[model samples]
Target: MAVLVVLLGGASVAARLDDSSSDSAFPGRPDDAASAPLGAPAAGGTASDAYAFIATQKGGSDPVTYDPCAPIHLVVDARTIVDGGMKLLEQALDEVSEASGLQLVVDGLTDDEAPEGDAVTGPDRTWLPVTVTWSDPKASPKLKGDVAGYAGSSSIERDGHRWFVTGTVVLDGPQLKRILDQRGGRAGVRSVMMHELAHLVGLDHVDAAGQLMRPSGDESITTWGAGDRTGLAAVGSGRCIPY
Candidate 1:
């Protein structure tokens, strides 16, 4: 997740009205990339969506906002990695749930088998798919690309009750393999898993250097932030729609 992994207060009355007129672009990368969305918001649009999460804020109970029982499925194959990585992911998920007041139910951990994408047309849709890539630890490169890791989709909007987030978290390559099998490997594993899970729950990088949302250069935020909580509340409340 970016840090403030943002959401789309999707299909508000105004957006639906302008869907035809707006230059629709998909916000995040899609698992079903064959079809470009008609009115999808992109990573750049995340800032705008973050703002929307705020504008649509409706209050909720102190100890309860987003449905605690809502199942947030993890669509990854954790079986391929060391046990430490899997345990770290579980703990990180627990942290996200504790922070957001929402239950992130990881459904079955299936193999990284995504059906061929349909004609990908970016509608306001998110899909969760998982993949695992393997490489030699000794031959693994030292540097990383812009995307330090990979994941499927997490935290999407659809029929009211169905909230799915299935994605990948790199686990098998050389450097990663060594790190996972190393002494006190939990640090690396936890950070990586926690970061990805953050995305699963809807967080985007923040300018605050130390926040989990901020990418590269530095690290901070062992827990969620105000924006994180607000986003969670917005999604959990199902308040994306105008009442």
Candidate 2:
């Protein structure tokens, strides 16, 4: 069975969200000419820089990544979202899209509950779009305590290659609301969203203090650092999968 790799945020940790789920029946690649990459990753950034991947290919450092040929669609659950939260999300997505060279589109809002496991299919047995939901500690235990948010992608092995198909990003509504009420809260909210989205795209936490991928949240660092950019570019440049 294909396993679900869940990369956590608000801390440096990686855990298997599910191991028994079967992803073998998911949909295959489209048959049309849309198989070509939507865009190429922004050039620059050296591998020698400070950066890390959430999961690397077996016996290799190549990060497991989404299919660059297709757009990564996201759906938001704004029920618990605070004012200006959606705007920050849009800004963060735009920044990540530019740095990674991947096309990300928000498919509007969803009524689906926050995902708690590795199941990637909706009621129709098709792959679900990346879900971005505002949640609380009671609803999502992973968001308990000081954790602000987390994101992870689920990948499946096919034709001897791994490709990320779908994922989820869960934000702590209360924690973020408190941050938004304080000074420089918007920057803080954007930083948290960007950090989690970085995880969604395969970037892992680093020890560098000034980098946005650092383990802890720091509102002072509003943009992706050098290492973060290097990692984003690498993951975004992953080999395109036609199937």
Candidate 3:
């Protein structure tokens, strides 16, 4: 298994962004066919636009992705959500879901805090629901500087195929507050959420200036760009895993 972390920095702030991946040993498991895909990708973008995947299957071009047949269960930490934040979060997720054709169900709010590191499994070794939470530098060292958010998923390789099981998205509480206070700040906040959620589903930062998946955030670009849509469609249309 391997865990991939994608970092997103504040749009106005100059910050370095990078992707990191770490390997873990897990017993191999069998694979089986799954039911039909829950939905199909929404039409968007030409193939020439810029887009990238965070990770790809070894020796293959297919991006590691979540199962299309299963709903991606999500839980939010209510303690960190700002005023009106929950509505914005829901809206952002809806956009991602529509673009990717993946069903994302918000299980509900949780008392649990964000994990300090990338371990998708709990102490009992079961996969955790995709977690959305807010944290500060004191709590998460990774959000220390201009970093606005972080998102990633852990995947297990089974019979030469890889599928994302679970992931996390952590936003900077204080920085988000500042963003919310700015003109058109609500849109800005939603853009950040959408960007991080995009990362959660396997989209990577592109060098294109206008795209939401660009390395740095931009309050003005509230919606997905052409390449962003294309990538979302690719990831959301992945093979269904019945494991």
Candidate 4:
């Protein structure tokens, strides 16, 4: 199975964005690292020829997806801006939205923290705007290791469909900030943001190198590849749901 979770320490592993939802956890699957390289693809591999989408399970089952036709509102944790600020995040969001044809709205900053083990509450808890935050090792134990970020959403059984209502994205602030200061700068930060956002919208990691969904910190590949664009197109093409 193609891993849908982000990379941790260059290892293909699952990371959860929904701390409170049991279904949000990464499903048990074998690692695909051995099947593909973990670096940039061969030279001259254009997006048209290089990207790969997240894979789905076999048998008759509804693929987990967010309705691309609907507006996806997001709120960023104020502290996450210390590295490169919201500008980079916004840039990546725009790029992904354009590629996936999903409507994205920045709902402003929030003090609502993340990496929590409790359930989401308040008016926003019912599933509206997705939350993006920067977490220290204490807040996100996964970051204490090689995992740079975590992105996933919570769904509900409604209208006989499992609709994704809310999601959370947690980044390794210090690590990402350090990378931002390196040569890659904005592009590097944006790629990481895009990778997590990809997961937020139901994209899983791929073993192939160069795709934005690859579970590695390799900065050589700065944008989405061919497979990435294809997968994003599918994710964004999901059926619409009433607001």
Candidate 5:
């Protein structure tokens, strides 16, 4: 309802780090201009009294640096019998991963066939991909059952990476399609997943209308600009503490 893919972008965690110098910031979300304040500081210094994770506003001026968790895998427990917009969301996520510099590996594990033991990663130097358990509107009314997704459990200690995102993101294909339709196709879809995945990596909303972290939706500026790249790089690999 209220959104923007959050903000920023970065390098391929899979890339040869030896070649790159540093990534960048401030891609700006589309919706920031029409609503909320920008670059406001947190109330006092207490973390508990801090602002909402995803907010109607943003304050801090200094950009979040890029340091993402590597090998971000995904698990898609989509319906064996796919439905409308389902395939679209999946394809988009993969494309976004490539564009955003995150390694999103999806697994096709059903709720029943879900691993008996290792939920995140197993001892075989492998982990439960992205743990995607699908559901529709009949199951989740808010999403009209059209929503199907999952959250990475907190402290999923598998491999060198930890579970950065600990919540479910119901990226409705209809809402996504409608909002993105204005901007064309691939570009719109990329924006949606890119924003959500950034949240997965621990990015907060930004106030800069020109920054990718903005909350309000904007279609005119479709691609993740330099600022968006900066924000995304910051979220991907870092000292993550998922609450």
Candidate 6:
């Protein structure tokens, strides 16, 4: 939803890797309290009651969107993935597709190895495919603190349409693993994955609490809320491109 949010620069890979090992943890706010995600929707409470939309920009002017006529190809880097991890991601993607009226197909595993504290831990170049990988804070600085995951796409103007040619989803392996290892952690992990996938489909964080796009993780909101479903449907209804 947040077009060109600049989660991380593709070119910053080299530098980030060099200093990744030493990058200090960006702890969540309120040392004594857990940090919640920052997203769209809901005025005063959680996202459950609120819904918001994200806008995409084309040439810094017109709004652009991904083609709804085709399936979104997704490839997973399973090198460090835990057993059944890919299953979870796929299921979550399926849910998103159903809600958005989009199709998602798993293209299988990527030959790319797990990142070694360098880059964004995704495809070497843009327009390759949506790449999903499990990584630590070293590979994703945003994972250092309360952040659970991140997702974004690369866009290209094609046939008078702004197409999201490729995208990336990075999960906090260590943190998520720890949560998964604990009681009721699987639900949390799945919720986080769903939230990130929503981002991939052009949903941005809302200010509400009950919504799935909440910046702060809410395990209870396992399924898509009304607002989330609305945004996803809209994103999937974008103009179709003839690529």
Per-candidate Cα RMSD to the true structure, in Å, reads: 12.0, 6.5, 8.1, 10.8, 14.3, 13.7
Write the residue-wise lDDT of candidate 2 on 1-243 in tens digits.
211112255222222223324454646564421567787766665544777888888678788887888888899998789899889999999888888988888989999775556666566655568989998889889887778889888876655567677788899888889888777788888888998998998888888856888878566788888888888888888877754
lDDT of 4 by residue, 1-243 (tens): 111223442111122235425543322212221222122112332344333333332343444555544467789886645555688888988878877777667979888664344233334334446888877668678777667787777654433444454678888787677777777567877888888888877677776766878777477777887777776766666554433
Model 5, span 1-243: residue lDDT tens: 323332222111121111123221111222212232221221222122111232111254322322233344555555432333445556655534543445455544445443433233334433234444344444435544222222222233213333332233434445444544554555554555555555554455555554434554454445554455554443332332211
Candidate 2 segments whose C-alpha is farther than 4 A from its true place: 1-26, 30-33, 44-48, 123-125
The Cα error of candidate 4 at residue 5, in Å, is 14
lDDT of 3 by residue, 1-243 (tens): 111113463111111112213223331122322478888888745654688988788898888888888788899986556779989999999999999999888889888865545465666544568889887767778887778888887775556677787888888888788788787888888888999998888988898967889887666688988899989999998887744
Q: Candidate 6, after superposition: displacement of residue 1 in Å?
A: 31
Q: Which stretches of candidate 3 lie over 4 Å from their true place?
A: 1-34, 115-126
Quick one: best lDDT, which candidate?
2
TM-score for all predictions?
A: 0.50, 0.85, 0.83, 0.72, 0.48, 0.70
- Which one wins by TM-score: 2 or 3? 2
Q: Which 10 consecutive residues of model 3 have the lowest summed lDDT?
A: 11-20
Q: Rate the local accuracy (lDDT) of all candidates.
A: 0.39, 0.76, 0.75, 0.61, 0.39, 0.59
Arranged by lDDT with the best first, the candidates are 2, 3, 4, 6, 1, 5
lDDT of 6 by residue, 1-243 (tens): 111111221111111222223423211122212122112222231223255444455455322445565567788876557557887887897788777766667879887753343232233332345778887788667767666678766554444455554567887777677667756666667778888888777777776756677667555667777777767766666665542
Model 2 lowest lDDT segment of ten: 11-20
By TM-score rank, best first, the candidates go 2, 3, 4, 6, 1, 5
What 10-residue stretch in candidate 6 is worst by lDDT?
2-11
